[model samples]
Target chain A: MTDIRAKLRGFVLEELVYCEDPDTFSDDEDLLEAGLDSLGIMRLIMFAEREFGITLPDTEIEPDMVRNFNALTGWIESHRQ
Target chain B: MQLLEDFLANLSSHPRSCCLVEGGLRLSYREVAEKAGGVARQLLTLTLPEGYPVAVALPRGIDATCAVLGILASGRCYLPLDLKAPRLRQRWILEDSRAVAVIGHAPWNDLTLPWITIDTISPTPLEPLPLEMENLAAILYTSGSTGTPKGVALSHRAIHAFSDWAKELVSLGPEDRIAAIAPLHFDLSTFDLFSSLSSGASIHFLPEGLTIAPSHLTAWLSDTAITGFYSVPSLLSFWSWKGNLSASPLPDLRFLLFAGETFPTARLRQLAGYLPHTRLYNLYGPTETNVCCHWPVERETLDSDHPIPIGYPACGDRLYIAPRHNELWVQGPTLASGYWQQGQLHPFLNEEGWYQTGDRVGRNDQGEYVYRGRLDRMLKVSGHRVEPAEIEAALLSLPQVIECAVVGIEDWEGIRPAAAVVMQQDEAIPTIRALLKRTLPTYMLPSTIRRLDSLPRLSNGKPDLVSIQAILTR
Candidate 1:
């Protein structure tokens, strides 16, 4: 779980977000509010699929599924084969 | 005349016909008319000037639609404000337009303008005010090369001409269910709102944030049975790339119109393969002139790797190429009146009534207008018009550093604004970004910020944009 969270956070901070400080961004911080726009969200999904080798369903790409680092980890875990 | 006439005709001819669909809620033409009439009655009470600008700060939905219609009915210019934009930017637009009142659900106590809550008012029997064709209909704000945004004041005649042309071009009818995907602030929404409503077609308002989820967006289009759609190429490309467009073939989608940015030939070919039944069109124009040129994509043209032509003139617009520079100049009925700045109408058109579009064009052997590029430094980042100067101005406003240069960094995804700055003290990327967030919208915010020793200068002492772009790319 920590591995998944760390990977998700690393990718988001490196690519998806430019405003938030990675070291200070809490696990529960809202990614959307941190300037993760629609394009960023799309790129994040692609990155997660390639990194984890899991097919995240398009219908399941809701705000609740990827709102925060913890939520992103749980979503990836559920989709893991 | 087309807007008011068609709206009245639709109301009388098909009172019970479904006019708007958002989520599970469906509003008929009669219901929409009643709600809009209520809003109009409330505006009539104020007795503002004939063409006073009224801002609509509400989110995109049934209420926003009714508010716009009510503003038009009351013979006032409707100014749609982006609710998600930075508060300071919104305040700037409000001050520039000198809006007499705001029609919204929530009370904007900080804005000192008259706030008219549409829901609180009751529906009353009323008729639309007799407005002339030259009267202002809407004012759309776009990123200016200067620091502030410029408002393009569109007249009723312009809206009438464009909507009429769009209605005929798509052969829109009562049975067509159009998707209102673009926000009200975007120029594309004018077609979705005016063309759909005027033609008696039903419009489905896609919920906010649904655009972020490509798969869900595709599913929503299929579930809603949307027959017509208009949007920017960025969103369509994103949907085609990741939204599983091949798996979910939207049969109900008849015509797809894309504009605001160039659509890559390869991505467009893939999209064509995914949706073979739908017709694709490339619309071209700035907010100053609504859809001056358009090209219907033929399968044969997609075989080549070259960019598609913007094709023939649209909306009764005449295209002219300047001799010295290949800049495209447009003269048409759909031309906006002028720019609304400092509560004054400043005419942008030349003496001959031709608006010089900053875009460069070349005529093909077939005499079709081929888009070359923009003559100016303006960049279309994700279908949003962005001026590097605007971002640079915002960055310079912050006392953090010395000089800065902003440029568009183009990757496989699309072009995005990136900045290189020389700072007196070392500042974190997040700090600069946080300061910029107060003034710039999320799209205008630079995706990448790199601290530089100094920006490369040319022989004339101007910042060398090519070298800066290379640095950002590296």
Candidate 2:
């Protein structure tokens, strides 16, 4: 299994924030509050699935996930195999 | 029915005014009529069965709207075919509508329909057709993101009712210059263009793909001095995302109409704090019923639990919700001709003539209906039926929650419901994953709780499901 949690953290930094490192972004940082917009979220979804081969189902695709790295990782960990 | 003709006659009176603006082109009512007349004369020459659809697959602009009017003036129903989408999607629309003729700047791709290019001839002024109230005018194809797009056939009387109803609500006149923001193919823009022109109100067209960027949007709003504008909730929310309403907004902007999606009460409240002086309204309708209902979102209503009320029917419109469900059944003078090609996929309404809107709605004591969500969005869990909207509502009720979506994911055994959420920055993101469990049952808990920086929205400003589906497909 791909480390869904670690992969999600990396996605937040890479696809979402373009952050230099995942450590800088917290699990709670508001994607909207931290300057993430709709366009950015769209790109993230495309990136996360393609990069990690993660098939995000509709129920799992929350609008809020992009708000923070911690939230993204939490979702991955909670649904871990 | 005489309004279109009267507007044509009054075209002579507005000589000095700039009527339509696209790219480098600007046309007065005279110029518009002249160019459109040139097209209409040629279209009138074509020998097609009455009610045969003529599709216009092209970029939206003054030319596109003119093409539509010309097709109708030639006594044929105009079918809008946007060239920007996938060609396959366009082909599906063509197959469904059985269009006989297409007017576009793009090269004719279809093997069957005759393509008519209007720029070939010099301008000739058009004469108004003797149109009846029941005469078929235009059939608009809506983005059936949930299913295949269907054509909504509207009549002259239905069109007239929509225009007059809007005019009554806004009390607009020749003095008001409305800006066209929606793609001509979108149902909301249908009203924006026709309702404004229903009277002699001048229309200002935003440049193609103009509002895609924020800097350009603010500049265009300022440059055009637009008095009124219609947009989707997602678009409006985007403008206010930075919470910059007090910043140099369009000084002349007054009436702001939004439709084609659900508007969360929280976002509306935030908008009120920003644009305190402007009037915001939520117009409701399916493509099938042009805009049958409306609810004016005043600053005061923002305080209610669910402030966005889909108000009373306009003109001869009626709305009745199904018992214990959110689906609203509508019957009105302005209803469309039914899905393209597919005559009767849904007869859920009744012999009395009400069409069921798959959306869920609730009525308050005043008989005002508040939209709940889609009926199908409710999912069946392990021996339990649950509404994702309920969980979403609970999430939003929490101060930390910003926006959310719930979907049901199937596993090896059965199905599980989950939620994706966007949150405010001040809150710890990791904590929320654990926090939501308290508010929801174990089975009801989202299997995954991903956060998004932003949500993908459709052109109509509703959430984009295709983009969402792409994530899962990947």
Candidate 3:
């Protein structure tokens, strides 16, 4: 689980370009408030789906569920095929 | 010619028809007209001089729309300011326009001008004020290179000319329900508001929260049964990339019109494939000209990798291509009154009344006018114009900043403002960003902030743009 969280954090910072530092974001902090817009959210979803072979539906990824790093990871884990 | 007058006539004819849908409220033409009349009556009570600007600093909703119409009904131009915009930017607009009064529900205390509440205004029977077609109707502000917002003053005749041509071209009617995607302050909203209102059609305001949320935006489109829509290319690109448009096909959507920035070909193709039934158009113009040209995107044009042509001039507009570089110059009744700075006609306007559009164009293989790019240093980031100098000036104002220069950095995604600062050695990127957020809008804020010993200088002692670009690119 820790390995998955770290990988997600790295993907979000470097690939998705959410923010400069992975450390800037806490596990439970809201990503949207931390400068992640809808476009960024889309990038996250796409990146997770491509890298982890998950089929994350756009309709299912509510803003509330993707509130933070942990919530995003939780969604990704449950949705992974 | 008289746009406001014609709109009032349309309102009276369709008094009981649904005119505006916003905030869980459906307001009919009668209700809207009465509310606008109340605003007009309250505005008259102020006894401001006719033709003076009345700033409407309200949130986007039915009330804001009524406030603007009321200002027009009272024989004065309305200057709509987005309440969510930075207070500094809003203040600059209020001061620059020299507005007589402000009317809105938003609480702003910085203004010396009198304020009127929109919801509390009492209704009164107002006689039609004799407003001329050539008289000023609205002033929309765009980002300026000099760190100040430049107001584009547009007249009633200009908007009427453009919107009439637009309505006829789209075949808009009372049965159509248009989605208001752009904010009231942006020039694109003019067509969304006037075209629908003039044709006795309904306008459904896309709530502010839904604008950035693509999924929500698509959901709203389905729920509202919006037949017509107008927006910038960036939003459409967002929807194409993320909104899952294929899964949620909008059966009621008839057409989608876009402007303000170049739509990426990949996303355009994606959206086209997703929505095969909807007609698509690329409308092009600066805020000054107000929808002077349009291009209907056909299947062949959509398949190409090249940027779509902006197409020919709309009715009542004359386009001149200068021999020097095929620079686009426009002359028409649709041209804006002038820039609001110093109350004089813009320097871009010639004695012959032709406004030089600063946009350079070239003919594609098919003889269509293809957009080359802007002749100026202005950059469009997500449809909002960002002048690097504006961000640099804000950075320099910070006490810790010694020197700074901003430049546009374009990559695969799009252009973003990047800053190279010669601040105190201890200052960091996050610190500079935090300081800038207080004054600049999020779009205007620089994406990349780098500390530098000093900005690269040319032989002329000016900041070397080429060198800076090389460094930023590297």
Order by TM-score, highest first? 1, 3, 2
Candidate number achieving the greatest DockQ relative to the actual structure = 1
How many clashing residue pairs appear in each of the predictions shown?
0, 24, 0
Assess each model's interface with DockQ, reporting 2 decimals per model.
0.51, 0.04, 0.28
Model 2, B407-426: lDDT tens digits are 66653223445566778986
When 1 and 3 are scored with DockQ, the better candidate is: 1
- When only the first chain is scored, the TM-scores of the models are 0.91, 0.60, 0.80
Model 1 alpha-carbon drift over 4 Å, by segment? A1-7, A18-20, A49-60, A74-81
TM-score of each: 0.95, 0.68, 0.91
Q: What ranking of all candidate models by lDDT puts the best one first?
A: 1, 3, 2
Docking class of 3: acceptable
Error of 3 at B198 (Å): 0.2
In model 1, how large is the Cα lDDT of residue B281? 88
Question: For residues B1-474, what per-residue lDDT tens digits would candidate 1 score against the true structure?
Answer: 636778789999999999988888999999988889888989988867554699998888899999998888888889999877898999999998888999988787677888998779687654898878999989988899987798999999998888889889989999999999888889899899989988899999998787888888888889989998899988888788767787899999999999999999988988888899998989999989989899999977788889989999999999999987899999999999999997778999888879999899999998889999888889997788999999999999999869999988998778889999998776777788778888988889887888998899999999999999999999
For candidate 3, write residues B1-474 as lDDT tens digits.
366665677766877899999869998887888888899888887877555689988766798888988888888888898665668778877877788899977557766788998879776544558868988888888888887778888888888888888898889999999999787888888888788899999999887556446777898899889998998787788688767687899999999999988988888999999888999998888888988888888766677687778887785788888888788989987899888874333545888768988899877677677889878778888777778888888988898899888888887567877878898867666666667766777677776777879999988899997788778767
Preferred candidate (lDDT higher): 1 or 2: 1
